[model samples]
Target chain A: MAQPLKFYFDFLNQSSRALYIFLEASKIPFEAIPISMLKGEHLTGEFRDKVNRFRKLPAITDHGYQLSENVAIFRHLAREKLVPEHWYPRRQLGRSRIDEYLAWQQTNMDVACTDYFQQKWLVPYLQKTRPAENAVNVAGKQLEHTLNDFEQLFLNSRKFMMGDNISFADLSAICEIDQPKSIGYNAFQNRNKLARWYEAVRDELGPYYKDVHGEFEAKLKQSGSSNQGVAQALKQ
Target chain B: MAQPLKFYFDFLNQSSRALYIFLEASKIPFEAIPISMLKGEHLTGEFRDKVNRFRKLPAITDHGYQLSENVAIFRHLAREKLVPEHWYPRRQLGRSRIDEYLAWQQTNMDVACTDYFQQKWLVPYLQKTRPAENAVNVAGKQLEHTLNDFEQLFLNSRKFMMGDNISFADLSAICEIDQPKSIGYNAFQNRNKLARWYEAVRDELGPYYKDVHGEFEAKLKQSGSSNQGVAQALKQ
Candidate 1:
């Protein structure tokens, strides 16, 4: 028997959750190796030297080849694995469209969302202190601008990003939004089109979205409670 | 015959120059429509409404379908046009590796280069003032860190990024580095491996690199002389 693909992930990371759901939904067999970002497992030791030189979460070692970067890994799976066509459809230049969105998300949406997540949760969690009011506000403002742009540019009177089918663009985007959303950011306020599209993608993915999102929420709650404890102690 | 793949680009933009070279080198027929980023042509009016809704440079319209983002356009060309196999070779999972590099570049290298360029040249050029000393220093420090990271993470003993053959990653990266290099930044300082890799890519590319780079240099000189004038006026 051939060796299964080795996936190193942490659900607290958005790309990790996105790819995890992708692997599960696609029914690709793989060994799940969870690496905690909180513990700095991905930053040093074996994970750094042996697995991924980039030291990023949600890396994969397929057979003997190592690959990092979420979008790259997603494309690799689409090409090398038995992924269905709908996720990265070839009909009517769908792949190009998806590619465009992915590129935009990498630069714009992902940056904004990740910055917001880092300021609001990750930094506070790591430092055992309250979120920096000014930094969080700045990140929030950027996130607001990005979400508005996302809705205006990508969202429309469609069930998903690429019309009817839920592509990886939608999957990746929802997970990105969740990074801010799970930490108490209201993304859907005054944005009905975005809300409808989000609901559609959520409905389409069903259990795959629910299970991974549940794990993410659980992790966030655990962190949140501990953070509150720290806040209380700081108050004293 | 097929509308010649209308490519809206500004040579001043790195991706534009990269894709222009790719289109030329690959012999894919494209109608080169230059939109000046300096004049804010890509930001408003028909270019924004009819061409690209995103208001970004290095955009394309192929057979009536629009596409944006350099990496996406490269992939689209590879898929839809008669691009050479070596540019995005499939053997030995070369495409995956290139994809990884491109993703990393979009987030890190491209960001640093653009920021540095903006601080060092574009911002001051547009505002008709000298470069902000503090901002330039910050951006320069970032560029230095990113250059080191790029050299360590991507460059190896290979003749190119994907070994022996010049891939799009090398092409794109060289153009990105030129964004800082053209504007008087010493990218080759103490980085022997990066310098060698750059020379190899430039040599392989031959005139495709030369013609575009010359035009870029010419534009830089024009803007640079005007910037000097502004400085001289301020001195008086």
Candidate 2:
């Protein structure tokens, strides 16, 4: 008679998609509650006061213990669930490496991807306006620099970020890249190593990646007029 | 004999001070190798290529396996070394709470403090110029907003972040706040809760806090003319 793990998320978010895939792939039993970020569902009323105090997407209540932040929720599940070792392998100090990347991503990759997504897509959709050319260009440049750093620092000749296996770092990074990628950003251009690694992660993730990413794409397309406006604006 | 743990750090950095205190308090045997960030020691030569490929401060090498990033090094120590259980307790899901704070700190608290520090102190020092009023004001506003968020979201009517005992979250956060504090930012202006929590953490840490913080202060003093210039510029 214990309360089930309740996951409240919006697929528009990169962390949300990554965690959704993680939950489904790991087969952790939980209630999936979709919160519409665009509608301000997470900001107003009950969800803010009672569910997540931070009022952020990609949150969960595990047996009444409310938790926010993507990395925190991921760690909580890894500790309290039957997560496969491959996701957070301890062999050869894999967990430490993942921890390092996650920390770095929080400061670097997450910032760049989220900023690009905002300028290219989210801010425009929210404001009912076209993407600001200058802002998008600035974000694009930053994203390019960050992707280069990501390749130089994390990715090498390995099939994935953590070698032959796909860890949460790969999952997290792929979803982060998709934030900009799905918004008409060319993340893989001129970065052959990153492109190959992306494919490898996608292939490894298979259906889970496809489904969540499909939902994300659908959500993007659902913002139909916004996308069209950006396309036309950029064209002009 | 096993190779003693090697810690490369500069006390001027917040995380470096935090980890240095942790090592001393925990009685962990480590070879403290100071890398001067002001001198660009972490950026060039052997430290960049051989020590940490990421070329960051507060790095560690345990049995020749190099690790970078503050939170990663903390977790690595917790897992591999005899860090006190109180630092990362398991009872009442303290670890999860700590993890949440750490993640939040990385994105929120750490960013605001570091940004404020850079704007108010580091940038001026590096460029041999007075602190830019506009940039410092912007960073000050951000730091103020972030401090407010920190109080509302994290601190409560408890002795510490996790109630009663000091965790790594408190340690990490206190150090982060000090970055701006050491540079003359008035962090405890309005938030009584944060002020109380800050005092509690400081009192709890006692001499260990004093020593590391003293070294940090000394580093600031050693910067000499940079501080004098900022003081004069702000007055004008």
Candidate 3:
């Protein structure tokens, strides 16, 4: 009997969703455990001390071997020969192409998305203060620039980020790119190629796509904001 | 004879220096080319239309093959089997351990250093504005938190970042961690574990250390400000 991989996830986080979709798609033996970032379970002693010290979400323990970071998890799975090589690519050039996107996105696209969320909700929801207009405007511009780069630099008419095949890079891109939607900003509004790529990924992920993002939409509808879980920090 | 690897570098950027030093240490056949950011060469048409579209430094050209981003470069070289296995590690687990650092640092340590530099120099040197007090304070706290994580989470008394032997992770960590020193911030001050790790990396890299970093020291000595060339944006 193979030991099941234990996945710790927070549904509110797109990083978590990306990994969850990836794990589910891999069809590997695993247990999915939801840890709420909104409720602040991530900071508790059990998670912080016993699991990930950095305390970010979407961590995995495969038969007592633990790993975090979406990129590392995908690579680890590939290295363990658990998932298809296409997800991470075994070829040097293919993996390098994916690596460039992985490295560039955290500092560029992800930061843009994070800043947008921070400006939109972090201040208003958490501090009970009006969102800084300048910060919101600045962050919005950054997000736009990142999206533009996504179109011009990576996507650029390719069926996927690394070309015809879908890798974890595409999975990561789709998840994070969907993040601004919590505040109702759809990156695909006017962009053609990006919109096409977004759809292709969704179609490929199948019903799991709806399961991951639709739940967020439902949460957004019910709660009126994705920032509420983090909002409690104001009292603390 | 094999074609030489073309390195496009700007001594102003420590990410460039890390790859530069690692390649030197690897004893790989390569040519080091400095593309001056000072003269606005990177933004020029030939450099952009033909080379890096993003116009960031630390790019490589090997036999007409083009690649950028420091991590991708290391992986490319390792895949080519040009460097020692220990630097990148052939084993999956070891590489995954290193990859975690590679992804984590860009967002944490690197951002902290960047923020501290911006606070200390960017606003005043070019913008003619007083440094933003809140921005500087925020950046300082972020740097402090990241440094704490570096010690408690990553290093944790290890000989190197990943394990006993030095890897590109150490080089990457050392280069970015040392950046603020150009502006006279010794992160090693008052820290024991990190200071020891800093010294260990310095001792290991040895003379090439002086060459890559000494240029920045010289630049700092001659210029007296860490953010001069970057300051030209204020004029624009």
Pick by lDDT: which candidate is best? 1
Top-down lDDT ranking: 1, 2, 3
Task: For model 2, give the RMSD to the true fold.
Answer: 2.0
In angstroms, the error of model 1 at B50 is 0.7
lDDT of 3 by residue, A48-82 (tens): 77777778887887767667787777777777757
Find the 10 residues in a row with the least total lDDT in model 1 chain A. Answer: A227-236
lDDT of each: 0.90, 0.89, 0.77
Candidate number with greatest DockQ: 1
Q: For residues A119-220, what per-residue lDDT tens digits would candidate 1 score against the true structure?
A: 877888899888888998999999999999999999888798888898999999999998888877899999999999988888899999999999988887
Candidate 1: residue A47 lDDT (0-100)? 94
- Candidate 3 ranges beyond 4 A from true positions: A1-4, A121-135, A225-236, B1-4, B90-92, B121-138, B225-236
TM-score quality measure for candidate 1: 0.96
- Cα misplacement distance, residue B99 of candidate 3 (Å): 1.4
* Model 2 ranges off by over 4 Å: A1-3, A231-236, B1-3, B225-227, B231-236
Candidate 2 chain A — worst ten consecutive residues by lDDT sum?
A227-236
When 2 and 3 are scored with lDDT, the better candidate is 2
Pairs clashing within candidate 1: none
TM-score for each model: 0.96, 0.96, 0.88
Residue-level lDDT of model 1, residues B47-107, one tens digit each, is 8788898999999998878888889999999999999999999999999999999999998
| Residue-level lDDT tens digits of model 2 in A39-73 | 99999879988799998998999888999989989
C-alpha lDDT (0 to 100) for residue B74 of candidate 3 = 78
